[model samples]
Target: MQRYELAAVTGLDSLTRVERDVPRPGPGQVLIRTTAWSLNYRDLLVAGGRYGPPRAGCVPLSDGVGVIEEVGAGVTRVAVGDRVAGIFMQGWIAGDIPGDAGNTALGGAIDGMLSEYVVLSAEGVVKVPAHLTDAEAASLPCAAVTAWNALVRESGIRAGDTVVLLGTGGVSLIALQFAKLHGATTIVTSSSDAKLDIARRLGADHTVNYRAQPDWDRAVLDITNGRGADIVVEVGGPGTFDKSLAALRPGGHLPLIGVLTGVNGAVSTAAILRKHIRVHGIYVGSREMFDEMNRAIAASGLRPPVDRNFGFDDARAAYEHLERAAHAGKVTLTR
Candidate 1:
């Protein structure tokens, strides 16, 4: 088998491909043959030592889909030949995140799916929606699940509510789709007009080019006639946190999902208190959330946008594409 491991806590240069023997599953585990993988901004952060110091030889990807090639003793949740994707936190099955969930995160705390085959707990994987291609299913384990958690789980997003998406990245684009599915008015912001156009085609009710309109919060207010959005998918971290607060109506929801901008800065808390804004820090989601999200995708026939695809051997190029932020949606690798 072939796998890419982070040889040291350096940058992309540390991503080393090496040969390894395919390991077998243990009791209550399953062996998976990977069919597809997707790159998230977190992957770049992990690879570049921005997320944290990862374990040496950590396989660096949290999102991937594969088929069950074999099951260990007492396994029954999934069977051989079933297509499945590993959940982000293998320990988090349902309810609130466990304290030790971080230790179970793939690619960061443990070996991930950037290999020809992987062994995971049978309970840690969920069967993907059958309508999706392997690459599309691969995209769900991180970005899509996070979007679902923010909108469908955390925020009780209702019809006629307004949602402001920070960018056209994987999470934002998938959130846009989910927001539309729930009949909410969607406003998407992006630096690129081409990407904004893509968001529009994906059911965004309005678009803001942050590059053109730097004060986009006021634009959101203007779009809503001085009323503000009901939810702001806050992916920009401290760089855009204040503006996200400004764009939200009183008692609105803010799901803080990413730190695409710098992680730390002075953020005014007065607005949050004054406006009664509900803020939730989302860390991907649980396997139960994955199952619920898959049901929604299957029901609505939702197809997540794939910005680009690379051959499995071209993993470096895929990472470079994500690092450049050139994609408007998920960037994937397929066997």
Candidate 2:
């Protein structure tokens, strides 16, 4: 087998390909032949050591679409030739997140999907939506599932809700899709008017050019006729969280999912107390959530927005493109 290895914590430069022995599935595990992998901002953080360092030479990708090449003893959920995708949080199978679950995140603490083949516990894999291809299915488990958990499971964003999403990144795009599927009105903000146009075409009810108006949250509030949005996919970190919170209606939901606007250190306790609000810190999702999300996606016939596709060998370039924020949707790499 061949795998990308982190020779050192040298930013994305550390990831390089090398030959390796084909890994055998241990008991309760299955070996997947990776066909497509997707890049996220988290992958950039992990590669640069900001998130954390992986074991040396570890394969580094969280979300993937692959075919089951073999199933080990005790595995019953999947078998050889099954089209599947790995759940990034391998151990978050059901219920609440356990202390042990955080330690098993793919592409970081453990080996990831940037390989020709990988052995993963059968419990961490889910059957891909039948309507999707390898590249499309590869985009789901991380960003799509996280967004679904935020809207459907945590935030309770439903039909007739006015929801706000920050930026045109993967999570926000997926959340936008789900929000529409649930009949919610969606708003998006983007640095580029061009990207905002694309987002509008994808069912966004309105768009704010954040570059022209740094205070995009106000636009969201104004667009909602002062009632504010029912939910905000708060991905902009500290810089935008307070404003995103302000842009929400009293008792609305705020699911903080990213740090693109930088970390928030202090906040107004009084404001939170005065206005009833619910905020959740989303970290992808569990295997069960992925399964539920797949059902919704399949039934709705929703496809993740693909910004661009990179050759599997040019994984580093994919990360670079994402870092530059040059794409309108999910960046993918195909084997």
Candidate 3:
């Protein structure tokens, strides 16, 4: 089998493709014939040494979908020929995240799904929605699960509530879809009018081109007739954190999920206190949340946007595309 591993944590050049022997499943494990994969911003961080220093020879992706080609002794959660995706946090099946959960994370803490075949604990995988294509199913484990965790599982989003999305990236676009799935009015912000148009077509009630209107928060207020949005999917980190807060209603829900605009910056602590904002720091999610989201996806027939697809061999090009921020939704790699 062939896989791409981070030979060094310098940049995209570090993704070195190499050959390896396919391993067999041991007790309670499954050997997956991975067919497709997707890139998250976190992948770039791991590649560039921004997230943290990864171990040498670390495989570089957390999101992938495949068929169980073989199963080991006592394995019952999944079987051969089952289509499943590895959960982002391997040990976080349900409830609160464990203190050592990071140690079990794919790509960062362990070998991930960049290879043609992978061995995973049967307990850490979930069957994906059948309606989704391989690329779409592969996109779910990280970005989509985070969106689901933020909107449905935690926020209690309901009809007529307003949601503000930061950019037309994977998480934001998926959040826009899921928010609409629950009947919430969505407002999406992007620097590109073209991307905002795409968001509008995806059921966004209103779109704000942040490049044209620098104070996009005020636009959200105007759209809601002075009542701010009920939820803000805060993906911009400290760079846009204050504006995200300003865009929200009093007692609104804010899921702090991304750091696309760099990690550190000044924050307006008083506004959070004054508005009674509920800021939830969300990672990807537990496997239980992934199952619930998959059920909703299957019911609604939701199709996540795939902005681009690359051949598996062109993994470097896929990473470059995502790094350039040219794509509107998930960028995928397929066999």
Candidate 4:
């Protein structure tokens, strides 16, 4: 099987095309014929040594959707030809996240799906929602699931509540849909007006062009009639961290999902004290949460926003384009 690997810690420049024999599945495992994969900043970090090195020549991508070509003994949840996505955290199958969850995430500490074939435990592979195309389903494991878990699992967001999304990235966009699906009013911020318009079309009740108004958290306050939003999916790290608190209502939940901005910034303690906000850091969620979120997405006919697709062989180009493309959604690679 042909695959792409970050051969060394030399960054994307070191991504090399190679041929290797595809392995067969042992008992309780399944073999998936990879159809499509999506790239994320985590893949980039592992390649550039920002997230540390992997176990040699690692195939670097966690978000993929594939067809189950073969299943080993004892497999029951899915059968041959079932469309599935691999779990990023192989061992942490379900339940509330344990202290050491995600210790072996695909594309990082272990081999990943940026290849023609891969094998995973039967329980580690889950059926993709019936409605999604391979490209759209490929974006779920990393970005969308994280957003879903932050809102649904951790924050306990409810109908009639107001949710604030920090940016127009993949996670934020997906979270907006889930929030609206649960009957919560959503307010989204983006540096682009054009993208904000798109977000509005996607059911966002309030759109703040962050570029036009850098202090957009204040806009969240104004939009919620000065009560502030009940929750803020704060993706921006230091730059928006303090403002995320400001955007929240008293006793609001701020699920810190990611720091797309460079890490390092200070918090205003007075504001934290005054707002009585609860700040929580969120990683991509468990397989259980993934399944629950998929049910909601499927039932509601939620369409994942996919900005573009690149052919498998042009993997390097895919990474480069994602690095530069201010996509309103995800970029996918068809393998």
Q: Give candidates' CA RMSD values in order.
A: 0.7, 1.1, 0.8, 1.5
Write the residue-wise lDDT of candidate 3 on 50-114 in tens digits.
Answer: 77655767898999999999999999888899999999989899999898887889998888999
Q: What TM-score, to 2 decimals, does candidate 3 have?
A: 0.99
Candidate 2 worst ten-residue window by lDDT: 261-270
Q: Please write out the lDDT profile of model 1 over residues 1-335, one tens digit for every residue.
A: 99999998588898999999999999999999999999999998899777765677789899889999999999988999999999999999999999899999999998899999999999999999999999999999999999999998999889999999999999999999999999999999999999999999999999999999999999999999998999999999999999999999999999999898888989889999999999998999999999999999999999999999999899999999998997999999999
> Please, what is the whole-model Cα lDDT of each candidate in the order they appear?
0.94, 0.87, 0.94, 0.85
Whose TM-score is higher: candidate 3's or candidate 4's? 3
The 10 consecutive residues of candidate 4 with the worst lDDT sum are 47-56
RMSD versus native structure for model 1: 0.7
lDDT of 2 by residue, 283-310 (tens): 8888989999998888989999999999
Model 4 alpha-carbon drift over 4 Å, by segment: 52-55
Can you write out model 4's per-residue Cα lDDT over 1-335, one digit (the tens) per residue? Answer: 99888888667887899999988988999999999998776777788877744556888898888999998988888899999998878776787677765666888878889999998888887788988989999989998889888998889999999999877878888889889999999998988888898899899998988888998978888998899889999888888888888888989998987758766778887887887888877878888888988898889999888878999999998888777747887889996
Winner on lDDT between 2 and 4 is 2
Question: What lDDT does model 4 reach?
Answer: 0.85
Worst 10 residues of 3 by lDDT: 48-57
Q: Between which residue pairs do clashes occur in model 2?
A: none
In model 2, the runs with Cα more than 4 Å from the true position are none
For model 1, the stretches where C-alpha displacement exceeds 4 angstroms are none
